[model samples]
Target: MKAKQLYTKPAIVGLTLLSSLVLSACGQSVESDGNSNNLANIKTTTLASSNLKFSEHYLTRDVRDDVFYFVMPDRFDNGDSSNDNGSKTIPESAGGFDKTSNAHYHGGDIKGLTKRLDYLKGLGISAIWLTPILRNQAVQGDSSGYHGYWPLDFTEIDPHLGTNADLKEFIDAAHDKNMKVFFDIITNHTADVIKYQECHGDGKPLFSTSKQLCEYVSLADKAAGKGYTPFIPKGHENLKTPAWLNDPKYYHNQGDSTWQGENSIYGDFMGLDDVDTDNPEVVKGMTEIFNNIISEFKPDGFRIDTVKHVNMEFWQQFTPAIIEHAKTQGIPQFFVFGEVYSGDPQELSKFTTEGDIPSVLDFAFQYRTKDVFAYEKGTDNLNDLFSYDTLYNDHNSSADYLMNFVSNHDVGRLAYTLDQSLPEASEQEKIKRFLLSNSLMYFARGIPVLYYGDEQGFTGDGGDRGAREDMMPSLTPDYNDNNLYGTDKTTADDNFDVSHPIYKKLAEYAEVYHGHEVLRKGTQKVIEHNDEPGIFAFTRTLKDHPSYTVIYNSAKSAKKFIAANAANHKVVYGEVNQQKNEFELAPLSFVIIKTI
Candidate 1:
């Protein structure tokens, strides 16, 4: 299952000849200013060009119809026990590789996920998105970087997760099943390592100095003896594995972020040293790092982390560079999406239109769906959310690429959120609401992402650690009964049950979604049903394909509706009482009908 076994290496002479011919045809030339010849620079005026054609050697994978299943490697499953405390470089205690502590590593690795490919494929997932696997700081502050956000080495995979070969095998296994794999990556900052000198009560507003602190010196005022000097630990100055990032100048050396305006973009996030993305040197350094990863690993796509914190100019240059690099390596349609973390359409659209990123996680969709279905808010809000689609660069394509989900690692679980929103509702009603919300996400426009453990009915109320609970016997032999934050509000089922009502419903609908191209890649038009309160309706249509209409009644009472178009329509999925032109929808239910 090694990568070499999966794809044969192309002859060097042939690749060079093909690249030369392709560049000549495009009226462009590749130049190497020298670090690496393969990492050539292409001069192009626009990234969006119809005239530009790549060499026939370039491979392409279209992800427009993909259904992504997001999993946190350490919290998903553990297929290997020997590597539980795997790192030889860092001590085990400092590495925090204990399963009992929720903040520490719980032994899930790539091998574990690879072993469960059948389970995932059976659930109808077309793609898998995992958090970063690069080496991370053993522990940061009071907890470990078990979530894989605090990167220590960009080039090497963490031993705790397994060797590079293990990762290659995982990807190979997934590809064998016709499933794409996406790696989550970070460029905003590294683990908290470099520090600054503490400024006393000068009323200058200094961050807490409990950890090592390096004096902050403005780049412009570093010579006057009035500026700050970074305090790098002995042997740790060159800590990042890729030698280029070892230089102190690569970091901003600024104080903690106040999260007010410009500082939010440039300052350190949660004490992690923010890279000076504006610096040409830093930009070149990161470009080399990611380019190497894409060329070596050849993942299907990337889920960019903390993209909003980086400068827009950096992305404008960086994104195109990565795409070009991938194309040179014979990968034409390498997909990429950013995490904007905003529920505002206006804010999110800027990254796609102005920043040049292809797509972004649909925070606005997640917000509205949670409000309406989980909180029992007016169903009109769902319609209102879709109305803002006009703000995107290409509304239709944007909807097709946007990553839609109910809950993720950073937020409260959907099950827990529904319970808290309607405390008096019975368990059956809560399950119904959860299923209804998921239906909207899967059937609506855009790619749907299911967070791990959500199908098993896991519930956690607070953010971060609370939401990321272990995935039952699949992840670990037994559930970690205590929540990381000790909220007592969080809860999870100890047993992994594929027969759960929600799991069964999701599997059924997944078959429908997979079989119908119109549902996967079609334009949606909302069908207004203002007279029927708590009922939402929409039609997904594509030329040359039969149109499908979807209806959802969130009301506690059954509702009836009549549509002449649906009179002779066939039931594609879901249950509804139909009689010629009239259809009766059960309480808290949904139905999918196809036009004859």
Candidate 2:
């Protein structure tokens, strides 16, 4: 028997929960420069998310439909250069290795981000997820907290990244722009220094060494005599352990190791040390930190770090407390998305169960898409990869909650990865693939997230440090090269050559996404594909509206596709002449069509 169709309208009636929510219209509203820098403008306004429309769907279960622009605070624009605090000479203890000077902190702070809210707002970005901002060890050259990941004190904001007041202003400015902020949180591990004393060449560790190390008492084995936790290095004779980890308050230690080695969590991100979320103290401290962030930052949502490393029980206890605490502050709606970073559908599904968390990064689908893009398989992998029935029918959280992206900071840049084999692919060809990938990201189901510099055709060869580069204003003057198509090119530190056609094309794509809800809320289907010639096309349809079809010519030459009985459709993003049924799609070109 065929499955029953889901009705568009709700069968049950219920009163909306938050009465204080001021729902706005769907059009774009510009924020005038009206003393935005002054703190006086903050409290008078709903500081983080006021301009855009907030639907019950989003407010109810932390479902964010808006496109997200993920920013690396230090790498993005540095608005307040005055706040540069670290030593100019890089320190040995930092997370930055010699290869990546861009990862070095240039002291980009909350004020800096706030100053550039207009830039993000103009891009039609509704959500912003900044890297971790918790207090971190401030050793020069130790790019730890500079990238916002080496968390020291969960309670305090990094002094180098500005003060609590600056954060408030940032949130306020973002709200003024109708943008939501997602705090990149880490309850998984503290600063990476195992023996801070040895690493820093000092007796005193950076932070309190004792409180950093905590006793190990499992939730099931709550017995106090279970003994202190020890850091055991794998396959090593010498156990390099922290001497004073018994005290629970002075320093925070990742409680336990994950049962599965590196790949259990997000396979791509293994730099993070796994914490035992099962310990009661671990649970308590994490809950307190989350509550503190909610009380202080008033973030629209949280992107929980390394969530799968922790036990299911920890989420069972922690998420509710965080959400409940936020509701009392009159911030009735609290959104939470966890990073379960597993490509296995079953593993990702485990983290999305009820009461566990509302949403998770769709690593399963994302990795599959990345693989398809890398392998040049067109849409061949999409069908088996995206188990829409299991996704929609399973007992996990709402399907809309999933976050999807083709490339992120942790992985190889899409442009860089795609251009590896086709190294000499023409500028137009490179731009073609980039634009097509982005169109897919936007029109596809789930919340789409764009990395910091993906819009400008940024290229990164490898993972981690390689994937991250400083966003320079433009290509540096010294280096110049021409591709197979003989187009002039220059290399800058991850800077955009705006003269490149892709940047303007990205602006158009962003405009389309920001202008229409159909891109975010529409249902999608693969309309056409030719396996032999490597051509693929898909269509997205909004409720009772005209459908939009996206076609791509993945071949090296222009290809013609015959759409039988299809008439009067205008190609928007791709190369398609208006003359007749026979139209050519340029190599690596992407086209979007809407029924006239």
TM agreement with the true structure for every prediction: 0.83, 0.72
Cα error, residue 331 of model 1, in Å, equals 2.8
- lDDT at 180 for candidate 1? 82
- Give the RMSD in angstroms, all C-alphas superposed, for model 1: 16.0
Best by lDDT: 1
Candidate 1 on 161-270: residue-level lDDT in tens? 88899999998888777778899999998887666655333233233324423333444544455554566655566677687666667877666666556667767776
Residues forming the 10-long window of minimal summed lDDT in candidate 1 = 1-10
Candidate 2 Cα misplacement greater than 4 A, ranges: 1-64, 86-103, 139-143, 193-274, 392-398, 472-500, 530-533, 560-584
**Total clashing pairs in model 1:** 8
Candidate 2 lDDT, tens digit per residue, 1-596?
Answer: 21211111111211111111111101111222332122111122111211334333333423445778887776665566555563333232233322224445655567767876765654446789988876665542234446777665566566666667878888887776567888988866655444322223334433332232322224334344443342323322221123222233333232332335533431112123344566687678678768877987788888888787665788889987897898976576677788886788677767777436878887776666655555566566665555452543344365555787777767657766667745554444444455556666766667778887675456664666556655533222211121111113323343433322343344445555554455666666766664433567666778787777666665656666566554766644434543344445655555566676
For candidate 1, the TM-score is: 0.83
Clash pairs, candidate 1, are 195-213, 195-214, 196-213, 196-214, 196-215, 197-214, 197-215, 217-228
Q: What lDDT would each prediction earn against the true structure?
A: 0.69, 0.55
| Most TM-score-accurate candidate | 1
Evaluated against the true structure, the overall lDDT of model 1 is: 0.69
